[model samples]
Every structure is written in C-alpha cells, then in structure tokens.
Target: MAYFSKHYHNPGTEPGTLVAKSDLGRPVTIHLIDYTEDHLEEVRLANAADCREYLERESKTWIQVNGQADPETLRNLGDLFDLHDLALEDVLNTGQRPKLELYDDQLFIIAAMPFYNGDKLDIVQISLFIGKNYLICLCPLDEDPFEPVRKRMRLANNRRFVTRDIDYLLYALLDLVTDSGFPVLEQFGYQLEEMETDLLENPNQRTLARIHGLKRELLVLRRVLWPQRELLTGLMRTEDPLIHANTQVYFRDCHDHSVQIIELLESFREMATSMLDIYLSSISQRTNETMRVLTIIATIFIPLTFVAGVYGMNFQNPDSPWAMPELGWYFGYPMAWGVMIAIAAGLLWFFKRRGWM
Candidate 1:
C-alpha cells in the first residue's frame, strides 16, 4: 500500500488561511438533499452560493462536498454557514487526527474513513459541521461512502429517516465511519491466517517479511481507530442540544464498535509477533537437524581413517615382528576393505541402538 502524505500550511502561516494545494486537483462536486417527513428534494449545485436559499428553508438539509474546493468557494461556504476560520483551514488541510470541536455556531467533527482500494487500505478524512437544522460533510477523497445513507432517506416508508432530525443523520454518518474499519480488518484477518499456516508448514525469509508488513499495517490501523473511541465518547458526553437524547444511544453503540475494532487490532498485533517467533524457531530447528547428521557422518569416518593410516605405513621388514604384518598378507588389499566396511557397519548399529540416528 502507498503511504498517505500530510498536507499543511507553513509554520508561520495564519490559522485561518486557506491555501490552494497542488495535490488536490479534483474539481469540487456539491450535492444537496433537503427533506421533511413527507417531502424530499435532491439537487446538484454549480456554486456554493446556491445553498443559501436551501439553508433558509424550514426543513432539514444535508450538504455533501466531495473533493477539494477553490478558495472562493470555501470562503462563500464559510460566510453562508458562519463556519469558524480555523475549522475551514482544517477542512482544506487533510490528514488530521480524528477529533471533536465545540464551536460557537456548530458542532465540528473530524473522522477518518477507511476503505480498501483493490486489496490495499486507504483512508480519507471526513469533516462534519452539525448545525441545528443542517449537516455539512466535506470529504477530500473522490469516493463517496455515504450513498447508503442517502438511499435510505429516499425511501418513503422508512420511519427511521422520516421521523428523525438532523442529529440522527449525524449519528448515522458517525456510525458508518466507525464501522468502515471492519472490512479492512477482515482482509488483515485472512492474511494473518495464511501466514500462520505457512509458519507451521515451512517458514522462509518471505514469511518473515510478510509478518513485518502486517505489523506495520496494524500499527496504522490502530492510529486511525484509537482516537475514534474518545471522539465518540466526547460526542455522547456533550450536553449540547444539537445531539438528541435518543440519538446518543446510537452514538453509544458506535463507541462500542470502535472499542471492538481496537481490541481486534491488539489481537492481530499479538498474532503477528507470535508468527515471527515461530518462524525463527523453525529456522533454528532445521539448522540443528543438519548439524546432527553431519556429526554422525564424521564420527563414523574417524575409525576408518585410523585403519587406513596404519596399513598405509609399508614397514614390511622380515626381521621385525610388529612391522605392520597386514601389509605382507596375500589378501592384504581385500582385508583392508573388509575391515573398513565392518567398522562402518558397527558404528551405524551403535548409533541406531542409541537413538542418535
């Protein structure tokens, strides 16, 4: 997977400054959904200024901005919604840690949404501005993950969306963001299981590399998921009237999901560590087996070498009694071969009986 680079202004730049970034080349696309219990109107806007007329309506409104917008568009949106300058800057500069900020006019939330792009994990920064009768979402990525929520709102018979206020909508979005990590975690689960199998059968350098790679991915997942639990807790504990009591219950469920994700990450990390240990043990065991076999072969050949050395000294003096008599025997060459074979056979039997083979 490719790494995600953080985008930020210069160190001395103003907090509210909205700088145009070259990395963000996608044109901004704005989609508006305004609805009541029995009415719904969906439209695509060419300019952020067009949202002013819908914001003035009595019905609840949801504005979704996909990709990066120009400075003029961002300023127009900030003026229309009274968005804090610092919050706008954050929206412009992505890669922010998930957090919750209580602004004077709205409840601001920053969340990381995780998804897989063809077997690789990718995260997009999603910023939400929750007002009394409206919800604004800004996503820096091109993919839109909120289509399911939009589809549900279009259904006429679904009371969950029909009977709820903007707060419930905010909860829905939060719940989606919290649960997005499951699929990514599921992919990790499959990879870890395969690694475990390979570790058991026969581990090599590639197995070790796979283990290290998985550990790094898990670390990234943990960084993205750990703060989310606290973010959800902050949302639930806030006394702001923006979030309803009934909707807080849903937020609690979302918090539980975050805790579950974190626990899974910890379990995966432990498994990755243990897999590395298993790989090392396998390599050590193979080396020991090889050394034992080599030692046995050398031990068997030692006595054979001594016999050959004694017979090779051709001291065949007829006057000396102990001058290597085997050298003078008629069957001297065959006799030497028989002696070496016997010695090898005896050694093999001894080793087998001693359970050292």
Candidate 2:
C-alpha cells in the first residue's frame, strides 16, 4: 500500500546537470554487444575508452550502462557520442514521464518498465540514445527488462538479429517494455476476481482497504501508461532518420499494446469503484435485517406486558362488588389463566396467518 515518489532536487541547481539519485553507491558498469551479418562480439568494457574502437566499427553497437554514471563519466560519454547535455541529465535523473526527444543526430527516448515485487509494483526508468550505428540504454542495476532481447541477439542463426538495423533493436526493446504490463495486469485481474468473490460471500473492513489500495495502484499504472501510448504515437509519426520507416511500423504495434494496457487499467478502476458501492450496500442490508428482527420481537411482547399489568392491579378490599366475587371463586382464577393463554395463542396464529413470523 506504500508508494515511492520521485526524489527532490536541491534548489538552484543548473539545468542539464547530471545528478545520481538511487544508484550512487553502485559503480557504473558498461557492457558492449557488437554484431553484424557475419560476426558478433560481446564484452564488458573496462572504461569509456574501450567503447571507442567498437563505436568506430561498421557493426551495430549496443552500449548498456548498468548504473547511474557519475557526472565525469557522463560528460566523457556525451563528448564521445556527441549526445546532448540535457538528455544525459534526464538519464541520470530518475522518475521521468515517458517521452521522446530528437537531438541533432540522435533520438532521445524515455520509457518506464514496471515489474511486480511480491504484490508491489516497482517501476524502473529506461533512457535510450538512438543513433545511426550505435544505441545506448541506461538502466538501474537491480533488473533488466531487455534480457530477452539480448538472448535473441545471441542466437547464432537468428537472421532477424544479424540483418536488421539498429532501429529494429530499439523497437524490440520498446516492444518488450510495452508488453511487460500484461503480466502485471493479469495479476491485478486475478486479485480483483478474488476480491469480488470475497465481497459477495463475506465482506469486511479488510476487503474495503484492499479495494482502495488496488484503485491507487491502478491510478499509478494509468499515469505510466497513457503517456507511453502517446510517446509511441509520437515515435511512429516522427521524421527522425534514426527510426526507420519499417521500424515505425513496429512502433504502431507497440502503440497497440499500450492501448490494451490502458484499457485494462480503466476497467480495473471502474471495478474498484463498483466494489466500494457493493461493500456499502452489504453493510446496510445487514443493519436492516437486524433491525427487522428486533422490531418483530418488541411488537409480540407489547400486548403480553399489558395483560400482566391489568392482572397485577389491586383493589381496596376483596369483598367489594367489583373484585370480591371473582377473587373468592376458585374457578375464576382458572378461567383467567385460560383466557390469557387463549389470547396469546390467538395472537400467534394471527401473526402466522399474516406471514409476519
């Protein structure tokens, strides 16, 4: 039920300044994967300089930095690749909304990858700098959503990996990230179904809290997804040379996936709202049933109390004309008892006949 927000920046910091927020303690690691039609090389680079030779080669190079690089290292990278300082700053600063920006020979893209960690949704920001021959992906060290993409590229006979442009690789990464929400949404759907069943059988305070918490999580998901759909649309419509026309067609597919995620999120939100109403209604119905039973019991006892009060009333003397005869007669006491019993039985029969019992 707890949510983590973005970290606040120090006041008066200049724009385009790289700041390390979460992964400051972890040293940055660079992994280079270079591939072409007939050759492939994968290695862990010792430093930024090790990437230079591969960058100059004709092969498509994928430079993946696993941690938030320090300002000096980022500056070196910016100089080496001619990346915009602003884009580098965005990469270091986490919790950016999904967006795409075009720079002078590069396409800057920001994306979010969501994963479930024991019922909690954790989102990681992925920033990409896509150039003609090289692609740089910046992510945290905890998890990599693109591991599948890497595995596909390592396949020896995969013609798609060997013959495709770097833009196709970018599309693959984005597609993976976009489709990641399906599993999370499926989890949500299962939880909601369970909640619905519980509400119908035995609604309680805990159920109410869960519904609210789920609603909040769905809101967070929507915030991440809507803009992502727009980002994909923007990528598909852009005229950037780094994103090929063929690759743009693939972006449309990614956009469709985003749309699907958004639709599911909306459905969950509505279901959560309806669950709240149903919970309230269940409570009210229980209250009404209790009240009805108490009312019936009180109505049945009212006349019985009246009969006992009349019989208990005392006269001035037993010999008086009003009470003496009946008080002295032994049969009078029996007759009075019979009358009271008959009255109670008649009342019970009347209630049964009227279906009030």
Candidate 3:
C-alpha cells in the first residue's frame, strides 16, 4: 500500500481525463448479474458495452467490473450508463477518500475496502454508481468480496431476505465493505496483546519497532474509516431517491459499524503509543540499575586503593624510619592485607545500612 494514490495525470491535464495505471497489466473482467423476485441470470462478458441489453430489462442489473480498466473501457462504461465524466475520472484515479456525490440522476459513492494480504494491510477503492434499477460497482482488485452477498441472493429458501430492490443490494455491498475490517482488527488485537506482554516483561528494540509499525497501520485505517462515517451519514440524511427510506435504515446500521471500527482504531493507537513509552522507560530503568551497581563497586574500592598506595611507597634507611616503620615489621604484609579487607568490608556494611547496596 502506498502513502497516497500512485495514479495521477500531469498538471495541465484537462478534467475528466482517464489515465490507466501503467502497472495495471491484468485484463479487466466484467460480471453481470440480473435478478428479480423470482428470476435470475448470471454471466461473464468480454466487453463493458455488453451490459446495455441487461440495463434495459425490468429486473435489477448489477455490473461488477474487476480490475483496473483502460481509458477505452472506462469510456464505454461511461457512455453506456450515462455516468458523469468526473465520476468516471475518479473511478480511473483510485484512492479517493470515501464520499457520496450526486450526479444528474445517479448517486455515486466511493468506499475503501481494507484487508490483510499476508501480514500487510492493503486497501482497495470501490466506486459505486447507484441508479433506479441498477448498481454498477467498480472494484480495483480482482478478488470478489461480495461473494457472501451473491450466496445470499442465490438461496431460494431464505425467506428473511426478501428485498429485491437494488437499494437493498447497495446496502449489502456497503455493509460488507464496512464490516470487512473486523477480522483485520482482530488480528491487530492479538498482536497488541503479545506486544503488551513483551513490553511489560522484557522489552527490546524489536518490540518498539512493532509498536511503531502498528501505529502507522492504525493511522492508515483511520484515514480510510473516518470519511466513511461521514459518507454514511450523508447517505442517510440526503434525500437521494436512489436510496429508499427502507434502505436508509440498513445504511444507518452500516454507519454504526463504521463508527465502531473508528473507535477500535483510536483505542489501538493509544495502546501503541503507551507501549512505546513503556519500552523507553524499561530501557532507562535497566541503565540506571547497571550504573548504580558500577558506582557502588567503585565507591568500595576507593579507600582500599588509598591504603595500598601508602604501603607501596617504602623507605628502608634509618633516616626514613618515621615513614616506613610498618614496612620493616615482620607482620607488615599480613597487616596491610587485613587493613584493606577491613576497609572494604566496612564500606559494604555502611552501604547496606544506608539501603544503597
């Protein structure tokens, strides 16, 4: 994942100019699903223009475009569906902040879908165009996150799921995208617990690095999720006809989920920051402990070194009798050893009594 969208045109480029990403080498695939109360048809098409006939039918049409499309394909989709030029441009340029824009007679929405690709977090931008009888979804990635919704639609015996309107379908898709973060959040939660344990017990540089990485990921999640809450609010409050009153209720639920995810991200950020502080404090504390032990050892040797220095300065002549009387004695060597040991033991005892040991 990049810090920003890698797709952009030159400074003087005109508005609504569609530029396909140079790195987008995969071929675009279109999946068409037409359904009603009791009728259903699903097929894959080789071209975006093939959706024209399906759009004319009485049943609802769902055109799922998977992969980054070229300029020609985007133009074909725009001309066929009467999509706004600006909306098409945004679709071509990925990594848009989540938002809802109203075109002449269509409602356009941009949402970010986050998932874990191995140990890395990646986000895909999904652009949706909601029409009276159709919902066109443009997914930047090839994986289908809407498989669960399709499975629900295919269950003929599911009585509780009776809404056949495209608005309901739109709600389902948004809800899926919003809730996809839960699993990712769960993974983060486990990592946090492990890091917290390490931080409290035996923190190291690796633990601090993990905390920083988590904070960065949480920041990215916040960027993706904060606008989604506002987008959901706009959808519920706006009097867009494409989103029916009944569907607004579902959107409200999805908005609640977005808020929940944001709250989780906020808490995780705080925890990461706290873990960093804990790691620093632990390191400082260990350093202080080591310094104290070294200082005590140096303090204990100070008097012992002074005594050894005095005895080493020897004068064996009678003229130096006043300075070297003990050096010539028979027990002088043992006496010096005893004096050094006594001084060292005394200092240790004093330190223990003063609670500095």
Candidate 4:
C-alpha cells in the first residue's frame, strides 16, 4: 500500500499546511525543459527557482519535481511558482486519488503511473500543474519515467508538445502515463490466462493466494486509474480557453485513451473473477475425488467386517440350549476360514461387476 498521509487536508483547504507521514520518499532531482517552436534548451537544476524567468516567458516551460521527501523544497517551489495551496497539499499526500482540479490560471491534475517495482506492479504518484506558459510535474521518488516524453518533446516534428500551449504538455504527460498501463495490463491478462491451466490441474493454497493477490492489485489499479478517466473527461469538456481550440482535438484523443484504459480494466476484472471461479471449482473437484475414494474403501470393507463380527461371537456348545455345536468339530476353525475366503471372493467379484473400484 502507498503510505497514506493521515493528516492530509481536504481538497479545498489551505495549501501550504504540512501533512505528516513518516514514509515520505526521498527528494527528486529537477529537470528543466525550456522550449519553443524556434528554440530549445534542456538542463538540470540545483534550485527549482532557476526557471522563474522561463515560467514568466511566452514559450512553454516544464519543471518536473521528481520526489516529495523534502516538503520544504516543495513548499518553496509552490511559493515561488504561486501554486494553489491545495495543489501543494496534494503533492505531499500520496493517498489523494487521481483527480483534476482547475485553479485560477492553472489546471492541477494528479495521476498514478504504473510499473513493476520488481515482480509486482507498483504505482508512482504523478502531479501535474498546467499553468499559463509552464507545466510543472512531480512523481514519486525514483528516476523519472517520462524521459521518453521528454525526448519526444525535443523532436522538431512533435508540434503537439512544442508549439501548443502547456495544456498540450499536460495532455502529452497524461497520455504517456496512461499509455504505459496497457503493457502492464496485457502482461497481467496473459498471466491470468496461464492461471486457468494451473487452476484446473492442482488448485492449492499458494494458487489461491496468488489469485487473491492479483485481484487486489487490479482493485488498486482501478482505484488509481478510474478517476483518471473522469479527469480526462473533464479536460475534454473543459471550456477554459487556456486549452486552445487546436489543443482540444488532442484532448479529445486523450479522452479516447481514458476509455481504452477503462475498457481494459473492466476486461481484466472479468478475467480475475473467472479465475476465482476456476480456482474454487478445481478445489471442489479434488475434494470430490478424495471422497469418492474413501467411500469405495468403506464399501469394500463393510461386508468383510460384518462376516468377522458374526463368527467372532462366542456361542455356547450344542449340548446346551441355544448353543452352536459346530465349534466343537475338529475342522471347525478351517471351515470358518474357508467360508470367510469364499465370502471375500464373492464380494470382490460383486464390486468389480458394479465398477466400485
């Protein structure tokens, strides 16, 4: 689970107030992209305030804050950039579900990017603020996964990010964040399809746990991604002129992307549900087989036990009333043994005839 901030404030609350949580990740390095249709400069920054002039300029600027371990630095950046208080609050609080907020002169969007931390899927929080001329991005503590987007931004042919306003930059970032989930879900779907074979052959404790774990991961993925769909929906329908008419076309593309992700999620959810049923049926079938074997054994033994009990009884001699005198005969024991063998053979023949084995 992502470390949720317990004291995190509400969405509309005052922004600069601190939310306390011990598991906050380490500080992230800042990457600066100062670009326009005519010029381009990509550089690293020791201080976030170095781009003040760029943010104030007419060209598009992007300042990506990599981590949130240092709230003071984030606070300073928020202060310097005139970011809304609630927006900064969202930065420190990892539990904030993905959402889109329109602040005065800026659009605040929160998104969770999915990737494999190891063999497991993990979500990295991405906070984006699309302002007049700059797009500031933030992510969980790690190497920025948006380097590919950055590379594309530098390409001369990609007017989508270069020539359009910052909203397009946001669209590019969100599109990349969303597009990455397809592969993860595709791999998951493949794994689930593979699970069908195993679940049928030998469903066990470990297999059940894996199914549950996968379901949980899907749930969390849905939790983070569903709202992003709505966010994109809002962006598509937004009347803010900050989103240029040309740019709304790209936003419509983004809206279609949201639908794609949501549909994929729904399909994966069905797969998970089906796997659960398969696991249950597999277990039931194994149980039934075990019970059948036990019942067959008991059926084979019932007649044999009855014969032994009848002969093992001690009856008086025939000389007395109600006595069994055959016991006094010299061959009585052998006769009893012979009778038992005959009875056992007859029962075995009957069982074979009935297909009890």
How far residue 321's Cα lies from its native spot in candidate 2, in Å, is: 5.0
Q: Per-residue error at 145 for model 3, in Å? A: 1.4
Judge candidate 4 at residue 298 and give its lDDT: 77
Put the candidates in TM-score order, highest first.
Answer: 3, 1, 2, 4
Model number with the top lDDT: 1
Clashing pairs in 3: none
How do the residues 29-148 of candidate 1 rate in per-residue lDDT, one tens digit apiece? 899999888799999999889999997788999999988767777899899999999988888888888999997759999999888888677788899999989999988766678999
Clashes of each: 0, 0, 0, 1
> Cα deviation of 318 in candidate 1 (Å)?
3.6
> What are the RMSD figures for all models against the true structure?
1.9, 2.8, 1.6, 3.1
The prediction achieving the highest TM-score against the true structure is 3
Q: Compute the lDDT for candidate 3.
A: 0.87
- Higher-lDDT candidate among 2 and 4? 2
How high is the CA lDDT of each candidate model? Answer: 0.88, 0.84, 0.87, 0.78
Q: Write the per-residue lDDT of candidate 2 for residues 268-303, one digit (tens) a residue.
A: 899999999999999899898898778776766677
List candidate 2 segments past 4 Å from native. 1-4, 22-25, 312-316, 319-357
User: Which residue pairs clash within candidate 2?
Assistant: none
RMSD of 2: 2.8
